[model samples]
Target: MATESTMTEARPEGKKLRANVKPAPYRIPQAPPMGWSPTGSKRREWVSRGMVGTIMFLQAVLTLRLRNSPSVGEVHTLTDYRSTPFIQGNESIYPTIVDALGITGARFFSLLCMLACTAMVYSWSRRLFNERVGLAAAFAFAVIAPTLVVGALATVDAFGLALLALATWLTIESRQGPAWPVFLAAPVAALAVVVNYSALYYLPVVTLLALLVSVRVVAPVMAAARTAPLVLVTIGMAAFTASVTSNQKMPESEDIGTLAEGTFHWLGLITGLALAGAGFYVKRARMGEVPRGYDEEPPGIGWRIMLGVILCLPPILAPVFLTLTPSVAPLWKPPLAYSALFTATMAGVGLVRIVGRHFRFPQWGIMAAVALLSIGMAQSSYEYTLWPNASRLAEVLATQVQPTGKYLASDPETINYYLKDKTKPTQWTPTSAGDPTKALKKMTFDLVVLERPFLSKADEALEAELRDSGTYRILNTVPFRLGWTRGTHEIWIANDVPVK
Candidate 1:
């Protein structure tokens, strides 16, 4: 009877264990099921990404179209300084890249650089701050009128600016760790200097600062390694520039004076400063020690004062130098001053962030300030669009002058490009400040074109003498009209001149 009871108890326990067991070929442990809901922040981020992509695509398209337009005119004879090498058919070293690249190639390359720079800036800014700050900086660069105009043409300014933006991005990125990438970027920076000699001045100042930052972040050994490529590339570029400029004659010192005179654009400088100041304030208030919602950092008073002082330096120095030494002063004109202000402001804000504990700012204020500054800059560019009017004058000359007659142009560069291969004139007439009448009298020319603005009182007297000499008669007095401004261009013909 005891054995029977034991069996009954054991059977009940076995049945209970069997009930808990499952029959399967293989058993797999499952991870905790993930929640399916999407957060608001994630959705907003996706939307912002889509918007940025769309905007960039549109900007690229607009820039491409602007570059392709023939109506914009050839950029070859934009300045007299660019005329000599251009007309001489010097292929190895062009005075200005606009002559070398041609319209299409220049435009394409410029657009490419602009887009790349914009993207790099956006990426760097975003990494440092929030998406809003990144967008603001990128948009500010993209919409800047001078940047757009320069980018549309075949000049080196746009390319230089692009390289500058790239260098800044690389330098900032390198601050995070080892700066191997800066070595790769050095060649590009060097190329920028080759393209524009002014970049030599600008790059060194920024590069030194960058190196200091890099050394502080990374070890000294690593910084040196990163800087080695820059040193090599810079040396190579300097050699190349020297070789190209060695054989070329220096432009007349007076011509340099004229260039300096034309470069003064005060409105542009002011706008640049204001924009920079606003950017600095916004960046500091948002990203500095004080959290945006909380008033912890108190607006970085020390940083603001320092930046304000720094921003004023360029403007002050520019005038003093211009007054004391006009030649050197104009060389570092409004553009450089404006660039300095922007750079200093950004640097100040960055310094504030390094010292601050938290980062946040009033988003609306930043956007408003950027938008206002961009609009003002765009308007300023519009106002000064046709300052020299060389291209427009060239177009007029092309239409007015006949193909068979010998024509003498005061601005030989413009005529050479517009009348290339046409049997118009013996190209040796001096239309600059020098006396060209002896040369003019020696050559029997059918027509003579003179840009009145370039003529001094003495030059005008000579022109009048030519007109009154009875050997040549006035054919057309082409008024050099520029958007409500009436300028003058005089055309004359010899009574019995031979066709070329």
Candidate 2:
């Protein structure tokens, strides 16, 4: 009680103070959590740029190698270039190459087209998201299996996809200010279909993308105004492409599941990560939170989702659609391919968030990235370089048979290419020609070749008729098919020809 005298309580002794007082409980100094901050680091910037340069360089080298390599099945088809419109473009450019270098060597054009596609992938992703996303998107395009094959495969699809990318980039650029792109875009869509009939399938996607993009940037009336021309132009192109290829025989299609799986199943880690990135964005939106620490602002998301959906659906649905055999048969055949541009960009986003944002376990993110690249490298070697080297097969044929009677095989274009000097273009007919059994009976074909595990019920029927009719004898059977394609190839010669 006496101590209640207003003397400040005497300070406790050191031991007592220690007993009562808590040490600044094993704490880190109060500071911002340390993480990667490359924003101002020139070294980091240069290192990233270096990586991108290396990737593009490697891709260029690979495509160039394929350009000079052996011809695969459909590669020879590009040699015709007759069905290809834009006579000025195709006739002017490709003939010189075909004359100087054989069809395989002429694949340089496809390489150029693919390079344009890859460059566009980077630019579109950068504009849509950020530079990191752009780098990642380009990397995905480089390593993904389809791209590995398509990049150098001598087909018109690559060229069409390149134009699609350019048109898309222009449309995206319009978000900033210019309205002239839509006018250019409308004509571009038509031009794409004209050049590669396969491009017709993408018209709907272009229209929808334009409408969504326009809505995001301007008022509804202006958006409609911008989109109307695109819609009209796309419809006209679609009609024109159908009319042009109406007489064309369609390729046999796989089951619905097969078509869908062909694309997404092979996609592996990149696709899963892309989908997860999309889901994450949706989740964060639902929770009313913004992503933290994003280095660059992303563009409006609605159009991007529209883009991804459109790119994915055609690969899955085209099989079913082609089976219906619409009155206006599109010359473009199955697996009408599209760039998974949006998917690739999303994959880039997923990898970035995991490695940079989730510092607790960036190792896992790194591992996924490694796995994607590894799969791509493995697939690159898993050649689609069609079986039965056409040149070797031709050599075999020259020994057993006379030059230039009607030649029938699964890939007419391939046979035609190897036999160009020996045979006339009209002398070759595709195995898919209807009721070819009647022609076999007429001995209309001097030499017939059939691939076993037949491409269609019709082919199987034709083979049966050939065996039962006894009009032809087996000349040689070569084992040339491998890797997902089945073939114990059969060669038939009219029985009258004396065996050498």
Candidate 3:
């Protein structure tokens, strides 16, 4: 060993230096851009985390209140329970869950999913920007009326959105190592599609965004990993859309005025802070302030997305807005859940940066705009929660209609759920089968329920028919509160039931 060392010592000093030195890695990960951390005390990170937790707590409280509200449940809430199964296969035993735990319990499962989405949004926003931005993004998403609505609903939207967000987080995180995360992303996205068909709409947009990020932040996305999911989701979405349209009933006439108002709310429903943040992001991009550890004129991939969105969204959203028609609206009319989520993420980044005086803008101006918009957003959200419920109709039905008796209703959607659980025979006639009045005349129904306050022309005729005919007698007209509005459930009983 000494002889070898002596021989080595005789070697040139330059050669020794070369031997000791290590070569650069074949695939070095990109370094975080300068100013990755926001300009603040280190405590900001902890403060942001705490704030996020508080927002989460507030969301949970709101969801619980909605759940425990006097209303039995939304008409669409329990309808989703059957869809919990996948491809109508044995893989999902979710229907049993509805039977075992009921509406509240199923909705609780969706809550867990919604919370997961919130967590993923935080992680993703934090990774792309900073903790404060993450908190802002999380706040933006949590406060969305639809987000809150889904939290209290036992629907597939929350579950599918959660998985989609998870897949997004995993795909973006691939920048750290470019190995496992990228590989797992496609499978999770696929599962999300399978879980909720709605997810299929936003998959391509998100996948494209992920591709841009993956390539810019760290090049060479795992071979076919990103593109494969997009192609599959596209094909699956088309197939599902065709199947849904083909099997479903023809569209019932809607109040175009109402749909238009709802669409307007969706377009402008984002909180004032989020809108401000999005504007700030655009402002920074225009100023060439490339701060988010990525490349190009618009600062980063996220900024580019915003630019594309601004240019593209108006064309698609305009028809729906201008026409006051649901027929012309695309699936993204309400902003597909994932699309809304990403917009919220950007808004979060924008809000934090805007509030920080990053652009030297007036603080009071920003606060005022945000406060006003936030109020508008809150109002729109409250409006969305005001669908007519069947709590009183349900109560009246229990006492008036016999368990196995024939029943028909003018607006039978919500009442169907109550009758489904309580009644033995499931041969109930609804508005879909044509005029409830004609159905009552053609076939004897033991009970007829007609909703009132603002009835359709046909519904008015039906109510008149029921009243004029001596064969039917009014059992009761129970007044019920629909959020802030008042309505009545007019229950009519046949003169005789099986006169035995």
Candidate 4:
């Protein structure tokens, strides 16, 4: 004990010893985990905005190029401007919008509509979700093959969808922020209905979305007051549209499936579920626990689940509802043709989450894939421009056949458009009352134009009937290139042609 002198030694040795002791395991600083982050820098916002603009520009250019590709099927805008209430409304709006923009051609009108839709998609998505999700949504809308084809056409579908997007944006804003925006949604909904009769189908889905937001988070009294006007206006528009267009033929139950095919599918369902699940986990993991005083966060998992259900239901119900042949036929027709923005937004969000979480792909990499896939899909249908073959056939008929006669056309819409200047010939499809065979046998046509693969399922026996009928003879069988195959049409001349 005596030998243990309490010496105050020079502390330099202690410092040297501590310095050489390998400070706290020399770990390299770990980088922050990558996932959903609500906050972003101004530079990021600018970059996203630029990307959206670039994508919209690309879509506009492509749409403008396809302006002359020909109109196939029943795009309401392609119909005669004065024939039906829907067509008249579409035509009336077209000139005003074009005049406002100072655009001279129909192509520019289509471009403008497509641009509006793209902008709405980006704006609504970004406001509701994040810039990343919004960018992805815009990218999806830009790159999808069907969206390009439909959006490029001079149809009310794009405009209708644009209005729908606007209404949706307003409704979401009203629920999340101000009460006034909900009132604005009412007028937008009415405009959507006026733009396209098919907008009726979308109304229910949107109402469901509004209810989801309003009932849960918003004040009940305020939500009710805001919602009542929207519902009433929507109903009023639907009734008015039905009354105005009562005479228009309902698209066949079978054809309705074709309209909604792109949106509602098993792949979309699977992808949606994956998206919701992944997003839920990632967000929960990042947020950990609800912060002490943080408000204005992105919607919770419950909202995500509800949204997924909303987006997925239309596609599933479309085919079934159309199959039933409801009395309100317009309501049964697949609504997604004009509601593509919503579908694309849902798809985009899911795709981005999946790519980032599952495959560990960076944002740029995901975008590259989206672009390439879109280009590939669109390019695959290069030669099969809608109605080009039909238009060319119309030209052949004008020069080759005498125009004075009742003509039976496989597709009256195309023939009508191409033959608008010729008044001598009147074209009609097989009558609505009877099968094609019976209808053709009953009525004597000067010319019968039959395209392979009958447009209507009930008209499947048309070719056989034409071949067996002794009153007619095949004058010409014109073959048109349709993608990888050639589609041939038989033009039959009545045996009782007047001798000139």
Candidate 5:
């Protein structure tokens, strides 16, 4: 024994012999324990929930105040229940509801959809980050002027946004348990894509969520199996795009394009391929079978996802501004509210984290900042596209136009809504197409109304045509205010020298 001890331990204190320690056994990553945990203190949770609820309530009350407002006056009408490909599904929804309950019901439905979207935003952020962040996101969404204005209109944007938020929430929930939630997300995503081509941009996000949830809940092989539904989503979107493009009625509708136009351009396709490759890499890397406590450590994959999404807000929100461009734009005009809410929520979260960790600033500072952002954004969005005096404009046009006369107007829908109540029986030509001197050379309109300064190329051309044509005389120039934008609409009568 003494000899053995001397051989094992008699090594000098300064110079130790190498110890034999085998490397840790290779273990596969195990699934996270399935459950839900409420984030943040109980008091804070109640406070956040209360604040979000109050904001939604206030927004609803404000919507009631603007009940007469023709928010979607120019877009949605009985004649053309649907305008853009994005709201194709909404064609059935809007016309049916509006035909039954009138415009008020349509606005109410939109408001309800927006409220649901706001609630989903709160729930998603609350589950992923914390109750405070969720409240901030909800508040931001609720206060955005576009959110309220668009929601109060009879448009599909609010409904599509609601569906997207629901799909996102379900995708996150898929990680907590059954794969059915993930499967359910596929159809929801497909519906959103059909409703608005711009919504196709969300396909990558849904695919990523499915892959993450699958890898965490099932084996790597199972992850691929779960992700198969993503292919179906892609196919569904492609079909919808093709079908919409095929149904163009106009000789040269600006919206005429192939399946991979605008939001689904080559850039989007490449980005989607990269996401698929990343998912495959994630699957291969996690093939080892480990225990279920993979999320016990700090900054787990879930936290990384949340952080990544927060960081991506800039790029994600930037594309929304593209709606201002006419040449190449998304079918459904982007409701800037989504980006505004995302930015405000991210800002709120960052400010709170910084203030709490470094400056010891009051928590109220975060709420204040969020409120200010919400109020300002909402104000900016109010009446941004709405013609407040559209009813008056319709009445004036009706008075000037004879029951049997053909009157050309910029927007038929706006005039149609007012005409619904008016006893006028005038026929209106909604096209703004005409050459400066040649368009009306063969055609004769009893009256023409041109809204200026013209934003549409065709409308500008028609306006110049009417002004330059010697056969027409300007009767009256009616001026109107569309929120911040101001314009004058000219009423022109054909100069008819009596044939007698």
Candidate 6:
């Protein structure tokens, strides 16, 4: 009986010992993290880090360049210089956000937003259908030329596009589950508006999308209550920042015009909203109605229609909007317009890839379109930069004049940059034109440079009056182009004028 009791106890102990013993090295190793393995409080870190690095590097390469070298020319230079004062004043955030981050900080942030957009697109594709569809959606975004080119510029276009893309991604992702990130998207979007006023146009669209996504996932009442405060806060913050920065009052009259003008003013917003709605509706309606007996499941007619609408909306609406509103019209002008077109093209390509199984058509078509558009734009830009009339005028002012001369020139910025330490020069402005001329009479300038191209027909009479005063003598007619036409730039010497 004693031996039996002892053996039973020892057997239990031995079993415990075997359980404690480590398995051989050949035993299956702990599975590395899979797509959706970890539960709450766990998330992938490396992927996010890698994505951030990629976004920053791509933006830097596209925008960074040596100072003093010509880059895209006047507009870019002016923007850079103008922003310098604001950046310096707000050194804490602006420096790191703008200069230190490189020339294309806005573009970098935009690209990051695009990557998030691609992620949402992939999710939408996968949830609606298969891995093949998801891959196709991603591929479509990769080759979009408009997006790539705009992404390449160091401008506000990328910033606005990025914010818009982020808003879209957050809305779409929220449909999957409780998306706290969607709420956070409001502040980021508000910041985007502060960066570029054009982004203000997207506010309504983003709010609608967020509400739509939240209603689909959570209850409508709850979602509305949750999102309402966020929307209000976003608008308030945006308005406050804009007012402080520009020292301008906000335009409160939503009577910004009738449907015709509103439609034209916010065309991109309308198109984006339509496409997003179409996409969501199609995805919801055609959840499992794939045709059988085929090797692959083709998207339903509704899906195809939605994709088509998304692809066509931008180009169709762009002209209508541009034509209707002349006040904030530059949004549709070249270079700037190119950015929107590029973003629309990218989104369209992504849609086509999702709807059509064949990718080559949209892929190659988008490439060709972008290439042709870029070439034409570049040629036009080059022509404007090398405007012969302006160049000739600058040459005369820089070379023909004697040193120690006091001169007045219209649009003196370009001349000042080129003719450092050559002459005492003052810029002619509407307010200063009279004062400057009087001063020139008093001290007697060696030469006064005035380009006919820079002045209107009325200003030509002013030029003749200055010559007729007998205080100044017309020294030479310097051919130049400061505006559009090739015209004479008068060089006047103050030899005949009495010195004050």
Tell me, by lDDT, which candidate is best. 2
TM-score of each: 0.64, 0.71, 0.73, 0.70, 0.68, 0.53
lDDT of 5 by residue, 1-500 (tens): 47987766655466554455345579778764544433356787777778888878976765555543454432453444355333334356546666776676767888898888878778876664556556655665565565666676765566667777677778767776688877888888888765545456556656775776567668878877777787678677867766765665422223324322433331232223223323332333221222345423333555455444642443244344333221112123235543443344454354344345334776655555555545545453544443545656676766655555566777655676677554232466665444423546655567677777675888877777776767787877777775567778777778882221
Off by over 4 Å in 6: 1-161, 238-407, 413-452, 455-458, 466-500
User: Lowest-scoring 10 consecutive residues by lDDT in candidate 6?
Assistant: 325-334
The per-model lDDT (C-alpha) reads 0.51, 0.61, 0.59, 0.59, 0.57, 0.46
- Give the clash count for model 3: 1
Q: What is the C-alpha local distance difference test score of candidate 3?
A: 0.59
Rank list by TM-score: 3, 2, 4, 5, 1, 6
Candidate 3: tens digits of C-alpha lDDT, residues 1-500? 57987777666675455455576668787885664444545687678778888878876776665522212222333433233212321124344545566777878987787878887888887776667568767776776665666677654567777888888888668655465676677778777766655566556655665665565554355434555565676677657655754554432324556544554465354434455565666555432344544442234646555544642353234334333211211122332344456666666666666556454664843574465346434643454335455665676677655666788776555566666667743556664366566666754788877777635677678778877877787878877554457777787778764322
Candidate 3 residues lying further than 4 Å off, grouped into runs, are: 1-46, 67-97, 217-226, 240-247, 250-261, 269-279, 282-336, 358-385, 411-413, 419-422, 425-427, 435-443, 496-500
lDDT, residue 471, model 3? 74
What's model 6's overall lDDT?
0.46
Best by TM-score: 3
Off by over 4 Å in 1: 1-101, 212-216, 231-405, 424-428, 439-443, 497-500
Native-to-model Cα distance after best TM-score fit, residue 345 in candidate 5, in Å:
5.7
Per-candidate clashes come to: 4, 0, 1, 1, 7, 5
Model 1 scores what on Cα lDDT? 0.51
> For candidate 4, lDDT tens digit of each residue in 1-500?
33333332322354465333456666887674544344667888889889988988877666555533344323234425244332324456754554454212554565566677777778767765567667767766665554565555444566776687778777777666566777788888888878765666777777766766776566767667768877897789877876766766653455654535633441244335335634554455222222433336555677667777676565556555444332222222223444455665665566556566444767744565555455535542452242336756776667544546667776655566666677332445533325656556765566778876455655456667777877777777777765556677777777776423
How far residue 228's Cα lies from its native spot in candidate 1, in Å, is 4.2
* Model 4 TM-score relative to the real fold: 0.70
Tens digit of per-residue lDDT, candidate 6, span 227-311:
7855885678666655555743322222323433533432343234335535654554332323333224444655455444543
